[model samples]
Structures are given as structure tokens and as C-alpha cells.
Target: MGTISPIKESTCCDPASAGTVYLPSGTSLILLMPRLLATTIHGAVDVLKKTFDGTYDDNCPACGETHAHGGICCGIPEIHCPSPCVCSIHWVGCPGDSFKHAIQVTNTSKTEREFTLTSVPFPHTQEAVAVTPGKQTLGTEESLQAEASFTIPETFAGSKYRTVIKVKGAYEQIIQVCLTVRPRQACGCHVEQGDIPKRVKAHHWYHHFQCVEDCFEPAKKVG
Candidate 1:
């Protein structure tokens, strides 16, 4: 025998608002609050996961795809100088021998530039290394063919020598040189002709001789 009150309108259902929920009188607000908070937290985590997992392209800001050179961005070091800004050269020889290699350098820039070439020896005497055309001027796209040599002294005991040739111009280029000097006697093994087995297969005989040769090989230095 009591009259029911009219249901008042609730403003919490607006889309512009946050995790606000309207509850009727006598409803369990405590139970609904956790569910609302959980939903809001789950939605926020999903958004964050998607943002972090988004795929992106490797588009360089300095030089775009149009200016890429040799599969590298033009603004980087690999193609900045003359196709390759850094390189390595290796040579194997005997002691008291001189080894020479030709190095081709080009000016890839748009203007004339002068390059000064210098060598920095590593664990070796400075007199052992030499580079020709120490200084040269090149027009745009012009190339220079230079020579680098390493002379192993007769009394040198080490089997390895290294040097770095630095070319300085608008951009610096690094050339790493490694020289391996071995004794003449270390080149081959001295297996007697009578040591071969007459009944062995050709491949097996070859393998056996290779292993024997390796056993007599001298220790080589790694650069």
C-alpha cells in the first residue's frame, strides 16, 4: 500500500564520458564497479598492444628511397664516399717478399675534391707499409688508381702485419690491409713417396694426404 516513485534519468550513458555507469536504487553498485573498471582496463591494454605491435617501414629521413645508393641510404657511410667507404684487402706471401695491390678510389660527389691518403700501421714497422698518390685532386665522378704495398723484412718473425689506409676528403674512407707472411718451407708437407698405400681408394688416399699435410702446416695468424 505505498506508491512507487518515478525513475529519474541518468547522465552516465553519454559516449563522451569515461567509465561512468548509472545504477538504480538498491542495485549492487559495489559489484558493478569492479566489472566497469575491468572492462575499461582491458580496452586500454588492447589499444596499447596494437600501438606497440604496429608495423613500420625503414624509410630514412635524411635520404629517401629515390636517393638510395648501393642498397644503402646516401646519408650513411657505406655509399657516402665512392660506392664503398670501408673495405678490406688481404695478401699472402713469404718472408722477404713485397706485395702490392691497386686501390681504385673515386669522387662520387658533385664537385671537385682533393683527397689525402695516409697509412696507419698496426703492430708493424712504419717502413713496411707504403701508399702511392698520397694527395690527388679529382673532378666529380673521377677515379684514381693508387697502389698500396707491404714489404716483409727478412728478420721479421711474426706471420701477420696489418695497416689501415685512411683517405680524407669530403668524406673519410677506410681501407683495411692484412698481410700474411709464411716461411717457404711451410707451404707444403714432405710426405715420402713410399708412404702411400697402393690399395687405398683415390678419394680416401687424397683425404689421408690432406690430413697429413694439415698436421705439418705451421700455425697461421688471423687478422
Candidate 2:
């Protein structure tokens, strides 16, 4: 083997000077953020790879450390990229008419965010549901009040339905709403009382009235 050259002595003689650095375990901590780089390198070409990946010297102020791809053995802080809004609702709607309900979406972030509202009725039911202002954009600290409406079919009964509202921006979030529909019998003689419109008479029936014998009787024939 050829004679080894004398090692250079410098102010910083740590292994890091040879192009490799050792970061103690737990020294790197990432909190409340998503990783910009899905992978990291620890080989001879680590520096070259980081430069090519465009993640060099991108230090997070929260943790005061460069990203893993930036040559710091210590863990890099999460991107902590700001979100467009803070959602206010999880499950909306209570036991009531499935035809309509109120909704609220708020944008609490410092920037603008885009959102969309959609619905999925119970597969077995014939009702069609929809959300008003389905798609919209909100600015910082802005909010929107939307309505969800259901169009009940002829044979609908008391049932529950669900709708999924998705908010997409820096990240994606899903919101769910449960809707309750009352049975047609809930009208309770509204048809006879004229409380309901004449056009809608055939669509609804009173539960008590249905159990009774037919109101009309056939006339007897004369000899």
C-alpha cells in the first residue's frame, strides 16, 4: 500500500470536514410539519444529490436546522407550510327535514384557499341532495355560509343520508354531514286540511287516514 499522507490539522478537525457529519440521535426533531423531501441521502454523492434536489440551505426557523437533504445529519424541521383555513365543522345537520340544512365554512389561514362541497345520498334512497355554493375561494379570515338541499322522490321514507365536503389547498381535508328525512305521514292530514297545496296532494298520505277503511262506498242498484 502507498504511504498515507499526513492528515491536515485545522481549526475544525471533526469528521464533518472530511465531507461527512455525525448527528446524534434525538438531536433532530421535526414538529407539526410535512416533509418536503420524501427521502434522504447519506453517501459520497449526498451533497450532489441535495443540490440537484433543490433543497440546499432551506432551514426552518422553527427548529433552526437545515433540511436533511442540505447536509445536516440532524433531522430537519418540518416545512410547517401555512394552511389556507381552519375548518369549523366536522359533522353537520340534525334530525329534521332532509330537504334543507345550514352550513358554515371559514378560512382562518393567512392566505387564500379553495374549497368544494359535495353530497352523497344513501344508496338505497331515491332522494337527490346538493350543496349551494359548491365551489368557492376564500381569502384570509373569510367565511362562507352554505346550504344543503335534498329533493325527495315519490317513495321516500324517514331515512338518513350523508354528504362529503372536501377542502383542498396546502393539504386536503374531508368533512362529513348527516341528513335526516322525515316520513311522508309526518304531514298528518295536511292534505285534507288544505295546509298542503293541491298540486302536492297525491304525494303525501296521513298515517292515521291510511289505516281507516276507504272513505268512498259504492251505491246499491235500484230494482
Which candidate gets the maximum TM-score versus the true structure? 1
- lDDT (10s digit) by residue, model 2, range 106-184: 8888989887765555567544457788878989978878886655554645665565556555566655655555666
Q: Which residue pairs in model 1 clash with each other?
A: none
Q: Per-residue lDDT tens digits of candidate 1, residues 60-157?
A: 46566443223456454345535543888898876667888888889999989998888886674645468898889999999888998876776654
- Show where candidate 2 strays beyond 4 Å: 1-98, 124-127, 182-223
TM-scores, each model vs. reference:
0.46, 0.36
Ten contiguous residues with the weakest lDDT in model 2 = 194-203
lDDT of 2 at 105: 75
Where is model 1 poorest over a 10-residue stretch in terms of lDDT? 210-219
**Scored by Cα lDDT, where does model 1 land?**
0.71
**In candidate 2, residue 99 scores what lDDT?**
51
Error of 2 at 116 (Å): 1.5
